[model samples]
Target: MKQIVTHADPDLDAIVSAWIAQDFLFQAHASEVLFVSRKVPEKFMQSADCLVDVGNRYEPENYRFDHKPPAFENRNSTCATRLIWEYLLDIGVAVRHLEGLVEITYQGDTHRNSEALKQSRIDGPHAKLKQLKAEYKDPTEIYQQMAFWLRSYTKNL
Candidate 1:
């Protein structure tokens, strides 16, 4: 299936990055995929199969390319990650949370808090995650806890 992504601004990078990772997973499974974005940077363009510019069209209703209706929405300060996460969930992609973060890995690869873990000695959030890890024997349990937290987090938004 062709996956079209529309970017309104640079802030959507993280969501786009996660989608790229998901594309990689799909490609590994021998699925055909395409990425379409407006005003995409050179770095991102290199990774995309097709690129289009929607120019000054802020209204999601006015957007249409390849004859497909655009899936557009305003994102929180985190940009499109939350919207992307919600879309993935709606589509039935199984995502598990880890330490209050959403993670989706089709292969053995996983999202790690390596940097956060290292910074834990200084940062409060990382320190809390570190403490949680210390208290739990199974890392999977942490993911479960994160899933619950994500539900609460999204609900309050």
Candidate 2:
């Protein structure tokens, strides 16, 4: 396997990486691609292989930011995560069964600068897990729910 790291804003990086991963899967004719990240963009759900949330806490440093629930119409972060998981599962990717943490290393060292170091700290996957747990009795059930949804969505596609 080959890895290509690029310098881009967080959101852009997520999109580009997801896209590249999708292309890799197509080129390699792989069953699925696993996307490991602390936070994944909403737009990448269409092409993701597996959306893995490695961090035990969603935003360890910024829990306050995610404490408040968004409006009913607003997107729920955990739901978004489940959506990607479901999308992949529908296409026959056994993502939920996979066990491991996803790690992403930044391309350059920014710790030398205090401001850069501060900017580097952001939320992790744990936040999404917490939110999902609050909504569902068992977080593991999300996998079944996602699989069901995937089954429905892929029928037409």
Q: Candidate 2, residue 30: CA error in Å?
A: 10
Q: lDDT of candidate 2?
A: 0.30
Kindly provide the TM-score of model 2 when superposed on the true structure, using C-alpha atoms.
0.25
Off by over 4 Å in 2: 1-8, 11-72, 77-81, 98-157
Assess every candidate by TM-score.
0.30, 0.25
Model 1 C-alpha lDDT per residue in residues 38-122, reported as the tens digit of each score: 5555554444432222222222222121111233332112223333444445555554342123322111012234543344335
Model 1: how far is 114 from its true place, Å?
Answer: 20
**Residue 128 accuracy (lDDT) in model 1:** 41
When summed lDDT is taken over every stretch of 10 residues in candidate 2, the lowest stretch is: 101-110
